[model samples]
Target: MRRIAIIGCGGSGKTTIGRQLADQIGVPITHLDAVYYDDRWNRMDPDKFAALQEELVAADTWVIDGNYASTLPIRLKRADTVVFLDLPAMTCLWGIAQRGWKYRGGQHDSSGVYDRITWGFIKYVWGYRRDMAPRVRSLIAEYAQHADVRIVTSRRAARKMLTELKAAVH
Candidate 1:
């Protein structure tokens, strides 16, 4: 499938899955974190960020990863496939901690955002299922009605989906 959107909370393994899916499908990948944050985490102008996303979506095929909920419709409209990584909050929180440890030295992330785990980020992850999931699901229903939606709730399920995708591709 082409023109995919991988969305989830802050630490839901969106980037990791996006990368693998892009590699398997041989398409370009865009991390919206990279689009939203600039050097030193300076936020990009909302207008500019939307414009950039528009340009990216114009491409014939791509795998984009992020959950900028406000702008989700932009990507969802163009995506033929949408993957929601609906993992447990605890799993996501642990993922953030693990990612922070791995990228502690301020290494460049594929998202171009070398972000630290802040209390706010933690809270966001903790509240995602309760607060964000409904909104995202609503948006999916509204904007991506025609797209194939895959809700991945566990790591094992995700791995299985990826394995099946890879097998299909090969």
Candidate 2:
């Protein structure tokens, strides 16, 4: 596929895979988080963010990661395929905690990469899947009506995806 989008509940490894996918394809990436979050943790205005998204998603090829339903429709329309990091709730919580720990210490984010983690954010990530999962799944189903979407429902699946991608690139 020329363009791919990675999405999942918080801390599901979208950014991580997005980077690897982009590297494999030898194309640019758009990290949706960096576009959404300002340096001080402030979010960009909706209008400005939508404008930025217009530019980023308009590319000929991109590996992007994020889940903004309002913006997702636009991205999904252009994406040839989607990779969903649908790990279990427990796993998602643990991952979110780890990522928060890694980023809260003044991390960097550019090109849709979150280079930092925070303890406080970890707790939020560690929980809330009960509510988040349904919403995420709904979005997936909605988008899948027209987009090619694959859900990776376990850690094993994630590794398998990496291996498959490696083989595909070869």
Candidate 3:
């Protein structure tokens, strides 16, 4: 798939999958966190962020990963494929812990934003399925009905999907 949009709760492996998928498909990848936050974690202006997203999606091919629900429609409208990482909250929380240890004193590989874990962030991840999934599902249904939507519920499923995708691209 060419223009893909990967969305999920924090630590749900969106960035990892996005990177691997883009590499396998030989397309440019954009981590929305990189676009939205600077190294120091300052946020970009909302209008500018939306405009930038428009520009990124207008490209011939791209794989973007993020869950900015406010701007999700833009990417959803252009995506030919949408990968939603719906892994369990505990798994996601473990992912965050692992990621934090991996990048404890440094920035995230894809975003360049420093790794800072907070109670709020943890709560958000823990409550993501309950609080965010419904809205995300609705948006996908509304905006990406024509897209190839894949919901990955477990890490094993994610690995299988990536392996199959890589094999297909080869």
Best by TM-score: 3
lDDT of each: 0.87, 0.73, 0.89
| Candidate 2 displacement at residue 2 in angstroms | 1.5
Per-residue lDDT over 57-137 for candidate 1, one digit per residue giving the tens place of the 0 to 100 score: 999889999998988999999999899999999999888878878888375465576766677888889999999999999
Mind sharing the TM-score for model 3? 0.95
Regions more than 4 Å wrong, model 1: 108-111
Indicate the worst ten consecutive residues by lDDT in candidate 3.
105-114
TM, every model: 0.94, 0.81, 0.95
**Residue lDDT tens for model 2, 107-164:** 5445535545556655555554655556767766776566667789887888888778
Top lDDT prediction, candidate number = 3
TM-score head-to-head 1 vs 2, winner: 1
Steric clashes per prediction: 0, 8, 0
For model 3, the stretches where C-alpha displacement exceeds 4 angstroms are: 110-113
Residue-level lDDT tens digits of model 3 in 1-170: 78999999988999899989998888867888877988777899999999999999999799999999999999999999899998889999898889889998478764554666789988998899999999999999999999989999999999998887777677
